[model samples]
Target: MTEPEVSDSLKTFGVVLKALRDETGLTQEEFAHRVGYSPGYVAKIEQGKRFPPRDLAERAEPVLGPLAAKLLRAAARSLTRKVGLASWFHEWAAIEEEAVSLYAYECRVIPGLLQPEPYIRAIFERRLPPLSEEQFESQVAARLARQSLLEERPNSSFTFMIEQALLERRLGGDATTDALIDNLLTQGARRNVEVQIMPLRQEDHFGAGGPMYLAETPSNQWIGYFEGHDSSLLQTDRKAVSSMLRRYDKMRAQALSPRDSASLLEQMRGAQ
Candidate 1:
């Protein structure tokens, strides 16, 4: 079978990876042994015939030190650049990377940042129009890449207020839902991340406006982002952003506390 062409971004990533590996003076076979991959697989990754796995970057960190992390970030950004994410979302994505503080109120599904690989894959598979196999895989890659932000910006504060019903709905079935809950609990444990669950029984809630994302930029300016199936709006107007911020604050107040949320997740996981 003929090999499919790789994107320019991936090719650039390959070049960077190769350069980093060469700087360590390790050949493909040696580096493969160090990284616990086959020589051929390493060769394919460097040749841009294959994309590097997220775990590969983690494993490579011990061998290549901080440079490996930089390489991973660069590769992730490259993949996202070519993944063809919705145009309306591009600005939010860029802003999200530099956010000093992020607050989210989600009613539909788990926020992408906290979703596990299995959960993410299942979500994509259930899309209405049904993404093509290639499209599905690319989207999965991009979403996972975006997740890197959680780790990359350790100083940033992230707060997610999720509806209790969404978790109970179990979008990806038992096993996937279990994993998702586990992941959420793990992330919630982070000192900088707060995960709160809004009870299903709450009749009056501030997040009735659907899912919203609010972020504090590096300059301390606040912005609000809202998205639907095909379009998104970035609110820079002070009044709009302030209104969304107030709603998020109220949502956080009404939702289960982080400690209680973790308990709920544990209960859900055990039930699964």
Candidate 2:
């Protein structure tokens, strides 16, 4: 696949930022502290997966010197660069950026934010209408970019409740399943993330309505997102959001705890 068609403006800014970081001889973590952002966020910026925040240049000015002006110009240009997200998903993705808390419950497939690279590719490979190479690359890029959220926002609370059956499905075969398990284990270890597994043999599993995505904005407002076979809905309606939130909370309570989830994942990994 050719490049994912990330914003050139952002890529240019990333190059400049990376060059500056190199000059300063600071690690991504160290540079992030200097600029008051998480290392993962900084890494995304440098990888061109994210646009520079409005205040990034100002925050970075002290270390930039003459390069500060260039960074500012690049930041301005980055705003207009094209993104890889589907049209329907763009709104949800934006909300995700500002979300203080996110909850996802998946019975269909792994949530996009939790999918690993091989798992992502396997999904695309099974598309019915057959996506063109360009479309595949674009979709893959968008999903990979979204996965950064787990690491990029340390302050955000991320909760994922996945069905054990999904892991057992082995969509991409053993190798990919192993990778997914490893990735899930790694992500679950993060202080900000919780991975819960709903066992396969539950008689009281009530999350039959389908997969759900919920977010809490910084202002404490809730948003719900649901995707169909061909379309997506972003529900800002209080009742709709509340309904999804309630289902998610109930399912979370029914799923395995984080520690137990880890143990199950480790056992699965060993089985592979």
Pairs with backbone N, CA or C atoms under 3 Å apart (clashes), candidate 2: none
Question: For model 1, what is the C-alpha lDDT against the true structure?
Answer: 0.80
Q: Over 4 Å off in model 2, which ranges? A: 1-4, 7-83
- Candidate 2 overall lDDT versus native: 0.82
Q: How close is candidate 2 to the true structure, as a TM-score?
A: 0.75
lDDT of 2 by residue, 1-272 (tens): 22346677777778888888888788999988877677877887788776565556767778666576566666665454465566566567767865789998899999888888899999999998998887888888878877767766889999999999999999989999999999999999999999999999888877999888998876689989899986899889999888888777778888999999999999999987
lDDT of 1 by residue, 127-147 (tens): 889998887777787777667
Report clash pairs, candidate 1. Answer: none
Query: What ranges in model 1 sit over 4 Å off?
Result: 1-80
lDDT of all predictions: 0.80, 0.82
Error of 1 at 29 (Å): 30
